[model samples]
Target: MIQVKKETLYAGMLKGLLTTFDLAKIIIPVSIVVTILGKSGALEFLADFAAPLMRVFGLSGKAALALFSGYFINLYAAIGVILTLSLTLKELMIIGVMLMLSHSLFMELAISKKAGCSLFYVLLVRLIPSLLVGILGGWLF
Candidate 1:
């Protein structure tokens, strides 16, 4: 029979709670900031600036906000932006796959480097596949 200690369970719960708090710290502030940017039309300006590049992925200029949020901040912020937009199913799927492939670049890249991976190689590996998949998805759907 397997036994679990009460102290061990409590410690695990504490760790989980702390992790959630850390994530919320990042996510909540980012969500609020992005909301402000959207309301103030700054997000639209950014989207317009990125439109040409975004079109290659079959996504609208507005999707640039989600992609930038996902890349710099995290996936939760990206989802917040995505929720506010009216996107087609195909666009959502393409963005979903691309974000899955390359989100959290700075944090993950640092973690990869700490794990002894070459930073440039890790970056290329993460970004190249994301771009390729985005292009393919754009072409197909």
Candidate 2:
């Protein structure tokens, strides 16, 4: 019993470490790239471009980068983008809730497709709720 417990503990620790490493691989590079883009003013230009649409969610243009990253990439990438920007707590909460509702779109859509779901339906279901939450959260929060 003692040996079994030790093995289980070690296995759990190893799995946790591997998961952290996997997330770091995605997050670190994204953070670095975002930082560079920000320094180059590229992020600002893109932020301006996205500002109008992002305004509907009550987020700043910079926050849109995180939203796009979350929708297209994964939550980890969005987190990376979020880390590089200075945002208010309200903005963070609004975008955070939005991402929670509709993140990992590409991968989830692929899985949904494999499960015999239509891409359009999956996107509609995920996006509508997320958009509504973002709009409401922006107004109320």
The top-ranked prediction according to lDDT is: 2
After superposing candidate 1 on the true structure, give the runs of residues whose Cα lies further than 4 Å from its correct spot. Answer: 1-9, 84-86
Q: In candidate 2, where is summed lDDT lowest over 10 consecutive residues?
A: 1-10
TM-score for each model:
0.83, 0.91
The C-alpha lDDT values of all candidates are 0.86, 0.93
Model 1, TM vs. native: 0.83
- Cα lDDT tens digits for candidate 2, 37-75: 989999999999999999998998989989999999999
Q: Write model 1 residue lDDT over 1-141, tens digit each, in one string.
A: 998999999999999999889777877776687778889999889889999999999988888888888888788778877876667898899889999999888889999999999989998998899888999999999
- Model 2 local distance difference test score: 0.93
